[model samples]
Target: MDLFSGTTFKRAVAAAVALPLAGGATLVAAGPAAADEEDYKILVVGKTLGFRHSHIDDTTRALIDLGEDNGFTVDVWDPPNDSAGWWGSGSPGQPDLTMDSTPFTSAEDLSQYATLVFVSPVDNTNSLNPATPRLLDDTELAALQGYVHGGGGFVGLHAATDTMHTVPWYGELTGGGARFASHPQQQTATMRVESPAHPSTAHLPAVWERFDEWYNYTTNPRADVHVLLTLDESTYSPGNNAMGEDHPISWCQNFEGGRSWYEGAGHTDASWTDPLFLEHVLKGVEWTAGVVEGGGNCVTFPEVDAVVAGLNTSAVGDGVIAGAIASLLGSARTAAEAGDPATAVQVLGGARSLVDHLSAAAGDRDLLASKIDDLVDWQTGLVDDGPALDLAAEAELRTMGGKQYLAVRVLNEDDAAVDITVTTPYGSKEFAAVAPTKNAYQAFATRLVEVPAGEVTVTATAVLDGETVTEEVAVAYAGTA
Candidate 1:
């Protein structure tokens, strides 16, 4: 499948159109409706398949206001009370969908927005018999995977980590490296800002306290994701899923070819009224959408000082190595405090040379070295030798001479090359050495199936440098039955 996006086609429809909200409300922004046509737009999906939050509407309204005032507009795909498109209550219930009047179902729909925001959209993870509305089905979610892998932006709030717990990709995309386990009662608690330089936390106090349902993740996301806020367990009773000390509450990451930001707060309607929370969310969306800049890294001086101080200097017989490391970290802290994270990263990089001295002396060299590298990566937003290895697929149903056929296109939309294999129930094709370019598409054609009118999915698996990523696109085949 080719790497085409809806943003390209949205240009023809641009002309300051009116976006529909749930409850028949209308919102108009300053620029075009499509995000990539120039003025940025956000798509918020508030439909819940699990225990629905009462604040979903409030959350949607708040985002609309944010976009209206922040040089952008908002389009919502909120199905009121139990509304689904093809799965249930027709498409009319989903008003002002990001993709015009359609439900937020596939990558084609998601391609129009600069950023996709999930306001506590609980996917069908906690369902028992599927008697109610459900979130994206398999094909829909597969489309979302390819969308994000092709440089899309995503933001998750509240129970988003709990949405698709069974899916490894969604868990990593929203949860960083872990999923939500449980939450305590809604109470006022203190959250310590970790990444003071991040847009979401820049205006927050070092010890910001607020009232909300505190969620505990299955594992600490600190090791894999750039952390912004950590909950202070001492301020509240953390129930069963208590993360003792390093409890990360909010974080952001540069994942695959997309940008992601997730926050565990926003469980209450009151959070929508809170100015701090609003600003935090606005900045997060802006950052994820590439409208603002700030590497979620910005290591605070206190955090760096604490990590260095925690090192066991006992391995060094004398205090020389310890003193030297301390001096370098001190300089880093100074640079960080002076609002020069770039200089701080450089100083930290220079300190890497001193880590070799610790290695020779048999100190905690590995720990220091790894932590230093993590700091630098967070600051520079660089991963895997500074290159993205992403493969994306786009598929369409083409009819030639009264007979229906499915055409596939694959785009190596990143900096590393991959060998792609497209598989379907009817046919499969292999493309070798797909170059790392975003503008080209590799095509293949097949007669989808013997059926008359039904849906089928095409899955593409790309492997490069010992890493494998799979993307899927669904095409519906319909001929005069």
Candidate 2:
């Protein structure tokens, strides 16, 4: 039985409206009379063997409408299944694709389409489900890979990351540098356009706020791909805060032999109707189809260097500690300039440790701390090193002697003897010798202190390698128990 022999194949090749090009011009596909007809065809696959979104059908219709407006032909394909039922089951305009066989049974069938748009093609979590049919068998997966590597285009929608978790090749092909870890409650948050020059984000504002499920990736993709949009974590309650302040929501990259684009937005049905969002999708489609040219490659070390230099000028302060930080920064820049981003990142990591110690010692919290954080973020995004020191302070509420106290945790990543001195508003304490361990350099030091109800500045000093470095941090005290 031929899978696409019925209405499925017929509808897939159904004629679409002429595609409109730039300057109000339209590219008409040659009619049946022509021996070789050239058509701009798009395939939208919304097959999900796992958790499905209610907006899948709506998204498909929206793309079809876009095709009509832009002069291209779109074919929407949803897997022939009703095991879990549709989003709005039994409702009018709901997609009902029925087929006796699979459409993507061979490479020849899949190669007919030029651009492939995956709208949440999720797989089941149970890898051992023998009864359930695999979305793309080994052959089909290879065919799709060959197609994309042969210059075909791919655009992955919202839950694309949630799909194909078992297939490692699919991850690389879709620019799944990071898997979807989790998402917070659907809320409105500001999205900063990272690559305004790219076609996908060129129409977007510098900072645009929209409501959707903001996702946190298991790994940050900024280092491996060109990020188009980043969710401003400060603008919303980032549920887990896993990706830190610089969270990327959308990115694009030229992967393998084809163009790959993925955006973390589009979880809601309303998003399909949004003009700006639709335009963004259209631009990505056009870019993948070779209609527009930009978003060339992933970010390089030089770009990271430029950002680091700017941050150093604006954020770094003055002191003996500051001088040491400046020297480390210089060395990192030199390493990067010499085409050693890994070494640069390692040196930057050491600088971050020094900054963390300084921030704890001097009791200067906001400005210098923020600057160091920015530098560390940039450094982390440039390379992948295992088990490196992430210098930062953590605060926790504690009770000491039947009184409320703020416990501050200052961490050090290196394995060296560090001399620590802490000065609080109440009194000063010094630890002559702090031993190093894998967990922390100063494990025995008491970061907990008692102060009046309000904000109080505390200074810490660390003497290491015969150099004295100091930092200050402001601690807020609620009240005594």
Q: Pick the candidate with the highest TM-score.
A: 1
lDDT (Cα, 0-100) at 455 in candidate 2: 41
How many angstroms is residue 123 displaced in model 1 relative to the true structure, after the best TM-score fit?
2.9
Lowest lDDT block of 10, candidate 1: 16-25
lDDT of each: 0.65, 0.60
What stretches of model 1 exceed 4 Å from their correct place?
1-38, 81-109, 127-134, 295-347, 351-481
lDDT of 2 by residue, 1-481 (tens): 3211111101111012111111111222211112143446777877766677777787888988898887567776675454453343322223554233455665566656667888877666335454555558777787787777766778888888776666777776666457777888999999997655466775687899999988887688766666778988888888874577778888876566567788888998899999999999987776676556532233333333333343332223435556676677778867855756567667877766765545343444344444444344433333422222222333334555655444444444345544445444444445554555321212122234543444434343455445554545444535343
**lDDT score for candidate 1 against the true structure:** 0.65
Off by over 4 Å in 2: 1-39, 82-101, 126-133, 295-481
Residue lDDT tens for model 1, 1-481: 4233321211111122111110111222211125444467778887665566778778888888887888768878766454333344433223444334434467776776778898887755643344443477677777778778766788999988877655678878885557878987889899987665456666787789899999988888765567788999999999997999889989887676677899899998999999999999988887777666543322333444455576556665425666776788788757755657677677887777777765444445675676576566455432212122454445555556755555556556556656666665456676666676643333334444443444445444455456565554454444334
The worst-scoring run of ten residues by lDDT in candidate 2 lies at: 5-14
Using lDDT, give the best candidate's number: 1
